[model samples]
Target chain A: MLNWIWIGLILAALLAAGVQDLGLVQLPGADAAVAEKGSRMAAVTEAAFDSAKTAVNIVIGLIGIMAMWLGLMRLADKAGLVQLLARALKPVLRRLFPDVPDGHPALGAMVMNIAANMLGLGNAATPLGLKAMEELDKLNPRKGTATNAMCTFLAINTAGFTLIPATVLGILAAAGSKTPHAIISTTLIASGVATITAIVTAKILERLPAFRLPPHDPPTADEPGAGKEATR
Target chain B: MRELLQAVATAVSSWAVPAMIGTILVAALVRRLPVYEEFVEGAKEGFQVGLRIIPFLVAMLVAMGMFRASGAIDVLKTIASPLLGAVGFPPDLLPMAIMRPLSGSGAQGLLAEIVKTFGPDSLLGRQAATMVGCSETTFYVLAVYFGSVAITRTRHAVVVGLTAELAGFITAIWVCRMVFA
Candidate 1:
């Protein structure tokens, strides 16, 4: 999965750079392409350095926002607000995630994450999402393998349901659009569809033979005679 | 109607953070909880989470950045134009949609470029903006969320995430056409 995609990106990048350098592929800027055939791979190496710096900077930027939200969330949890919210959403969330027990902290984190996302609050959403993941991980039967709940949660995050795409609107407004908000309903509709698609796909895929959990539960297996051993 | 919705959206976006924080702090105060101490403890953990994400972010972004700089997307654009044309989608907007799942900044840059090249009021610009609005940066989300938890075996998460992204892109194009075209 991630391993293949990571390696593929690196491999394809090197291959593309090589092809461009060899003049096998015509670049958009013909003059510059001809002048810098040898520099294609060098550009990739440069990008690696630049992106590493950018990555650190991105995290540094997140620290303030993450701290604020996590602090607020901590206060919410302490006030029992998180549990109240989780309980309110239990009926719906239970259907989406049957594995997570009622009133679980993960449910609260997820509810907050989705709420933040709906408000187009990226700064709040990521920390809350990661918090949700941490809570969900606590319930993992296997240490490294992703549980169905995790997959569903990730699916929802990737779908990114939103009421207003503030950043995109801001970009359009900055570009001098008189009607930058014209796409609001359209974005809402599209993201709604995408979110539904992601949940359904995750549910369907999780039930498939390839992705199903093994018949043997590890924790049970660890304790000899704790359960009836099935013959393989 | 649109203007009213926009106003409300703007107001919500502006006030959401303050309102949420205020409510939480107030609620904690009323409950007699040590809000300041709890916040500091949570903030400390937040700092740790940010630090932990550094390696994963570097790994994911470097690979994506190299791929972006390699001119691979241009090649993909050239290869994908015919298919896009068949569906009546603007080929020029392909780069933004493709980059949407990979990098947030890259997609933002592309959206800005498109808005600059094509008037923001134009159909292409509107479509690009909608696409950006709808689609999440799937790879970044996957890396950070899973990475924070140290979960390496992400079984169907990638597949599902990409499916969601593709669905968002297509729906963005279709909905844009229906509403703005």
Candidate 2:
């Protein structure tokens, strides 16, 4: 899926640049006037290079925040705080992922990931989410294919029900918004709706014939009855 | 109603981070966890995770930069504005909406630009900020998370993710217009 999007972006970029170079379309605004100095293609290439550099810088910037959150998370985990939190959310998690057995490590990991995400800890969320996915993969009957649980998990994560939206606030503050945090309630409401939609959509889609997992693939490990357990 | 909501938001924004940290520390203390050692271990893991994401970040960011700089987003904005305008979405926000699912940094840059051009107090700026807060970079998340697990076939994840992003976009516009207007 991303493969197609990546290719499409590159193709569309080249096509747009070609059109600009040919003077086939003159865009309105200062942006159009800037194209007079050089070819749009060259400019696009330069921007891509610049963004590549920026990407590295951004990652480096994330290290400190990521380390801080993950460190706190580790302390929480060792102290059984994660489990306590996970237990509190178990009923909801169980309903969302019936395929995952009760008390599964994946459930714990997923809970932690969601908690970290809600705090707007992007770096921490990714590792924890990856950890959750790895745990989910262990329960997959198919070696390469994604399971329903995995899809649902991804959907919810991508919905991004963040409470703080720290990055957006930081950007708005830097941009000199007198009320940088004014969007908090709106963000919560919007993302909350998106999260519900994502879960419901994933659930319904999995039931459709197109997305249903094939029956021939038998559960290879864990409980012999675990495969049947997932079917419910 | 709007004033009350804004006040609540202000309170949460101020206390959210500190509250989270406080909760974690209190939990650690109560549970008698080795706070300092555990932190070091997790921090190391976090550093490794940060390193792993670099390649994926570069790939996504470059694609985004190319898309934006090639004037493709402008073309999209021109084409999409009328259609989106009918639904009450500000045409100027089309680029950020389109880029939201593709790249986090790309969307953040667009959000900053919107705030700069419209002023952070402007309706468009507020809407863009809310949109940013609500949506995730679907493709980036998919790449890093799925890539980590070596999952090649994503199945319905992309569909569900994009659906969520669309929901966030529409809701952001609606909520912002109601609250900030």
Candidate 3:
């Protein structure tokens, strides 16, 4: 059903796009001017190449840093840095994710994901996301609807992460903007809004009765009493 | 068109391949490092992830290649042009956007073309370059993510990712606007 809904939305979007292409709507003033501006933009593309290099460098640099970081983090584990960090943050994470079991294995993965993203090392974040999902899958009390926690996590991931602003800053710098750092504020605002949006959406969706059904559901372990509501 | 092809060939052979190999070589060297034997398992994990993702990268790249060959890109550009300009995107950036989604090398080709066609410091060229830098290769990202996860159901990923690219596009334009305009 969700698949069909997704298909419908995509189809609708495509059709509307097609109609728009057919000239059913007036072209925006910006686009007309923008198209005209293309010839000139060719000039800027050259400079943009120089500017674009920073982000790629950062990304590539992050790759190297990750291997070192990973190796170091393992060393940190032996040296008790992770324990110290976790010990300090345990109170906060527990508060943020209340229903999650205190010893939930996902705590490690989630923190790891957050940290990697902060480094602008999204490629590095995948392992943690996968591990987090695996851990979450184990604790799923419902064999049905995605839980509030799951929904919330996905929302946070999708809404955008702001800790590392390299990608945007790199673009700004490449564009030769004097205010490359300007995005620091927007990052905070945008990511915060996204986070809030995700949290609210996840919570609301969790309460919806229809979410208890199959197919629209996240696969989960057998949980007592969770299935009774649907059968009723 | 020749420049675009050249850039892509360069990117594939020079940039991407070298980086991939260099990384592996570095890893290989580290493997010879006497720091610790226990780290091998973790090092091996990275190798496995790379292995899993490579196929996806190749597949998506091929799809992007097809998209370029299909002339669907010009259509996309015509559609995105207005929004592109309003955000202060130079027209040349359209090709970058068109090519960017498909491959970094191809985008680099477009970027180089813009630079060659125009002065490097030109507003449009700079903006297009910036856009290329700021965004991820959508096809590459999809390939890596899906291939790694082994997902049969891709869900709303393609849409959401494209939407993110649109956001990146608008952001690039706006930044260009505020600075260049």
Candidate 4:
């Protein structure tokens, strides 16, 4: 479905631009209407290229952050701290994901990811999240399809509860809000609701026949011990 | 009540990071782990993962930028304002609401613009800030996590994530109005 969403976005963009260019749909406050159609399209193309450059820059920006967190995470793992964290979070994780075996590394990674998100450490969260997903993927019976555990994990992370919201506070402070931290309580309440909703929705959806994963394919040579590994 | 909540938030925001780091370091030291060596090894893996995500990021970011640059977001705002206004949400925040699911930077820019225009203390500005703080960029998260694992079929994750985002948006508006108004 990501494929469909990506395609839909690109198509919708072109269609919106086309209708405006043809004067079939003239938006009241659209600045694109002021420019010539050719120029408007050129600007859109330019923005896409610029965003591509920005994307690469963002990845480069993430390297140091990712390295820092992942390194700490490795140390945590070596210290058995992550497992301890996982064990502490077992009651919550078990309810959220019953399929994941007890003491799995995915459990540790997921707990750490959620903890990072709650602290509003997004730079730390994303890499930890990716690590969790990869670890969960090891348990996936169907290689290319997202499993129930993966979906639930993604849902929770996407609607992650934020206790601090440091970035928003920084923006508010920069904009001169006398009470820049005022939104913190509201954000916590809202994000908490979002997380609960995500968990509930994911649980319900995964039970539906439509969202069920397909039958597993026979293990291929490249996936050595895939069957055995999944059983573990 | 509000003042107490705000005070707790301020305290957490000030000390949460240092506390987390300190706890981690102490735990590692107690366990006699070679913290530095393990860190370097993990950092190497992170660098590779960062490199791995570049193509996916470019694909998602370019698509998102093209959609916004095409004025589709503005069009969405114009179309959504009336319906949202009927429900008491400020129409002015529709751009940030729509962009929040698509692009983090785009939403941040919009939020900054809203705060500047409405004054940071104003109702709309507070609402926008709360909304920004309450949710993650759904599409971006989906892309990066799924892309890193090379998962082609997302199944229910997209629907579940968007539903959560919608919940966050509505709650943000409601809670902000209740407190700020």
lDDT tens digits, residues A1-232, model 2? 6668778988999998888778887778736535563788888888889989987897788778767766776776677766776677789988899998776767877987887788666656776787688679888867567899999999999999987788898999999989887888899999999999999999998888777777665546543443354431
Candidate order by lDDT, highest to lowest? Answer: 1, 4, 2, 3
lDDT of residue A170 for candidate 1: 90
* Pairs with steric clashes in candidate 4: none
Q: Which residue pairs collide in model 1, if any?
A: none
TM-score of chain A of 2: 0.76
Name the lDDT value of residue A58 in candidate 4: 88
Chain B TM-scores of the candidates: 0.91, 0.70, 0.65, 0.81
Error of 3 at A68 (Å): 7.8
lDDT of 1 by residue, A108-185 (tens): 999989999999888889999988998898887665789999999999999989888888989999999998878888
CA-lDDT, candidates in order? 0.87, 0.81, 0.50, 0.84
Model 4: residues >4 Å from true position, as ranges?
A: A32-38, A218-232, B1-32, B87-89
Give the CAPRI class of candidate 1: medium
Give per-residue CA lDDT, model 4, range B1-181, as digits (tens).
8678768867875686678667778888998877778778888887788777888888899999889888887777777878988988788988888899899888999999999999998888888988888888998898788878778789999999989988998999888888888
Q: How far is candidate 4 from the true structure (C-alpha RMSD, Å)?
A: 3.0
Q: What is the TM-score of chain A alone in each candidate?
A: 0.88, 0.76, 0.60, 0.87
Task: Please identify model 3 stretches exceeding 4 Å from their true place.
Answer: A1-232, B1-38, B47-55, B69-71, B78-91, B98-102
Better of 1 and 2 by lDDT: 1
| DockQ of model 3, rounded to 2 decimals | 0.06
Off by over 4 Å in 1: A30-38, A217-232
Interface RMSD of 1: 1.4
